[model samples]
Target chain A: MTDVDPIALAVFLFFFLLVTVLGFLAAKWRRGDTLDSLDEWGLGGRGFGTFIAWFLIGGDIYTAYTFIAVPALLYAGSVVGFFAVPYTIVLYPIIFIFLPRLWSVSHRHGYVTPADFIRGRFDSRPLALAVAVTGILATMPYIALQLVGIQVVLEVMGIGGAEDASWFVKDIPLFLAFAILAAYTYASGLRAPALIAFVKDTLIYLVIIVAVFYLPTQLGGWDSIFAAASDSFDAFNTENADAIAAGEVSGKGAIPPGAAHWAYASLALGSALALFMYPHSLTGVLATKNRSVIRRNAALLPAYSFLLGLLALLGFAAIAAGITVDNPQQAVPALFESQFPGWFAGIAFAAIAIGALVPAAIMSIAAANLWTRNVYKAFLKPDATPAQEAKQSKLMSLLVKFGALFFVLGLPLELAINLQLLGGVWILQTFPAIVFGLYTRWFHRHALFAGWAVGMIYGTWTAYNVPAVGDPDSHFGSPVATVPFLDIDIYIALTAFVFNVLVALAGTLLLNAMNVDGGGDLTSPDDYKADAGDVGVKDLPLDEMAPGEVAKGTP
Target chain B: MPDSTRGSRNTRPVWLLVALLLAVAIAVPLLVPLYDRATPTFLGFPFFYWFQFMLIPIASVLTYTAFKLSQAATRHDRAARGQKPPAGERGGVS
Candidate 1:
């Protein structure tokens, strides 16, 4: 293979070093602030305003998952792939509805993680542990997905490794990048990602805007781009008509055909419901200055969806530009390389790599927060000091990253993607406990725990049975499956969610009949309405909590 | 125990309207059959493509409107509870 281009490598390394320096310096972003507690390290002192909160959340949402995963769908001609656009549009409104209550209650109770919120709200340590373990397990593959995004960009630049390079050598760049990220996140906590988000997002928006408006012009125009994509799909379908008839492959299309209508809609609805259920997404909300900041961001963040909608279409732009690659994930990066100059293309590559880092940092931190708050404090050391808790979170963040690195280095990428699909399903199983607890305490903790367990098993089993197309023996092939009796294809997560709610409802009714004592509610109604200046709504870290403070604050 | 009875005490019609606005914004885009067409093209864009892009602004305006309504409703709720109005409503940091 040819050596990597000197000019592009220089430019990419320049921005990479710049972001590394910025990440290390972010330990001091807030002057005189000490990284001594979960509140400061895990949630960035819980003081980010509307602007910084917007970038941080945007950094999480507009991630490699957005830039790479979404476009690769359209490039590969998956009809249901465009479901991502509607998925995001539906997400903000859901956020506008439920997230404020979560923020308010979390502020009132010194909760550093969602599991902490569950422990306080439901007072069931076992149920909270269930939630915490699910969050950590689900997030590990998500972080690996981000590493895949960066690896794709590096491969396009020819810096990752040559075609036949050894696996360890092929992944050295990712290892170096993750090492720096782990170090800075340990030092500054959430603040490192929160600060670097400002740079990463700006570069990303510039690259997308330039590529969206400029690429179509270079490849004829939007009309021809659409036409070219449609024509390409038609030719592919004709060539593979025999395989399509045998169900060995899915048909290529620009939009959902009649049968896929439910698949598209259910995917949108299901992902919208699952998005906020992710611990990393909530880490952004809890870090905001107050409840209003979350609402304001919910409204303002749709601007990124508009940008994302445009970016997803770059897959079609690749078609019209005649950019072809065996792996569809390589199309967009290869587009930037062939279409843009060496220098600007290097800048774009750097942006994508850095973009992946933001969510990777946030996801590991969220997972670590769960381990420290729910598993460690709840079970091992009931009276662990705040300093000790922060130390635990920092170390756990490293361990979590190493676990994700195992997924990247030790396993195949497709297996990781399939597990990430299940991750979405498993995380959504916590919705009954979390979102319901935000509104009412009616659902018994035991009932919710049972629902989570049932949903997780059913979802995993169903997802495991869906055979891969073109190879009828493999499983975890798709996220959608046919409904049992209704016989329409829909997202497996939504179906599992329906089962979860029904089981929780029936179990709660039975428990209420028996008068089985729900441990106790540690929160009051006012806790859901409290804000920054409200009584007992102090923004103190858990380590700062004095003895009997939780007991005293309950009323 | 005292706060448990006040679930609806601070509730306002604006809050109801906020929920309505957000619900519509969320549900309208998920109704795939409504705009899943390629016949009508705008600026060389299919109806399916442009319509979803258009929903972005339509949803934004609705959500922005909901943001303001919630801000006002929250102020009224705080005032009713004998507390100061929430900060950061007028671009002020908390």
Candidate 2:
């Protein structure tokens, strides 16, 4: 809120440089034979153990966006924001059942991206391309949103985002931070984030642990915190009863009302189902050493979920502490600056900024792998060698980061957010092809493709038509929409998914009866059950079998 | 092939239990209407707030046990396929 605190600035810079050095140094840590293969660079040799994989995956899922937006929802009196807690609670149980299957198949076939799996499983180029393109498209706004996370923290620190300042000055600090991130990621690939995650998680846990335990006592206790939030919501509803009745204003509460119970549950469930489908989340899963690593982490990772719930409650604490901010995203940051001492606030700022950096690094690398393996290797240069493929991924990671930069700086922030809003629903459309295909090839390849297309078109169109509350003319206002036949509202993505399944089932039956070629299943049933030590399951040399080959590439 | 297929089917109940645990873990949280209330505050936190926080640990334990039970089934499946207990089981994951 004020000009940069000099002591805080020094503390933030010290940790920033510390991690900057760690990012470059990671290329040599647990040295791979060469850092020129996708396995080495894009996936950190596909060699992370349980401990490192936990931090890496944690970094990807529990992002800076969660810190900013989750609390902001409560601060802004949006009850559904609390859905994040249940979303994460449900997420691990779901992934435990499936991610190991993905890791096994990915390692078995050297399938570097989900699209690689799609192409190999379904043997359809167009379908693989759809999955690949959606991964990249959905990923870009996400990386941009990470930049927005850093931008928010920097603005809170008085570093950039001065409206009066020239454009360069307004963006220069963020530009510099991203430049450092881009260079390290290009140098070290997945290793950069994996190594730095240690530092990022340490800072994050320290700040959150201290903030949760310390902040509550400063403003009485959790009892008063919840009471204050409830009272505040009640007060607002009383004042805005007329506007609420007129449908111009939303009534606020600590818990979702009965009418919104479906909305609350659907958003949580839909997001949980959609999350691992994102390329970045899958990248972390595939990067681990073996199947057990994933399952154990599923059990362990909920520790973060517990802390995340407390972090969400910080919104209520901010209310009780009598802090106010115009942009709700700044509420937690503002609360930190007001309550904590100078150096500690600096550490908190660094935590959020580094939180942004780790995920951004991982996302760009994942999207880059998708482009190199699925788009470049699969189509542009089918016989490209491992070295050439890695070269392409290295260069593509840089370009993907630049595209994200453009999203943050070039276009309006709303465009990136709206696209990200669509990104969630858009990415879910690929779920049937990737997830359903893992368990059963019962869904026909072309049928799944048609399902994907229908889902994507329907989700985008429905989301586009959902006007904002009070601003009936605006588009993409809410992610929830009224179900077609039901009076209740739920996430549009889930509804689209229902339609997608019906179409896929119908399409499969019709296609089969007409004797359409269903494409060969390159993977055997045992492939899903393959583990690290199994034959044909390590990182396959590219010439032996580059992923997405229609014919059997297995020697 | 029939023997191996039957081998997997013979162990179906343990796999079924894992499935049941996971199903409960996933479905119980989505039944939000059951806990959507302000009555019966626990240590000053509302029933709604404290109850959801409590589900975190319950769900974690359920998943943990599911992982343990499934590991045994996975080992049996691997043995049926004439594979070792997955270098993962020989020692913990590297």
Query: Top model by lDDT, which number?
Result: 2
Off by over 4 Å in 2: A25-61, A161-190, A383-395, A402-421, A540-555, B1-9, B80-82, B91-94
Residue A422 in model 1: shift from native, Å?
A: 2.8
Candidate 2's residue-wise lDDT over B1-94, tens digit each? 1222445445678889999999999998889898999889997788888888988999999999998888878777777767888657776532
DockQ agreement of candidate 1 with the native complex: 0.63
TM-score of the first chain in candidate 2 relative to the native first chain: 0.88
What docking grade applies to model 2? medium
Model 1 agreement with the true structure over B25-69: per-residue lDDT tens digits: 998998889988997999888889999999998998999999887
* Interface RMSD (Cα, Å) for model 1: 0.9
Give one digit per residue, the lDDT tens place, for model 1 in A13-106. 8987787678667646554665443243334324545465445445545667777777878888989878878987888888888888888898
Instruction: Quote the positional error of residue A51 for candidate 1 in Å.
Output: 6.3
Task: Compute the TM-score of each model's chain A versus the native chain A and list the values.
Answer: 0.89, 0.88
Candidate 2 overall Cα lDDT vs. reference?
Answer: 0.76
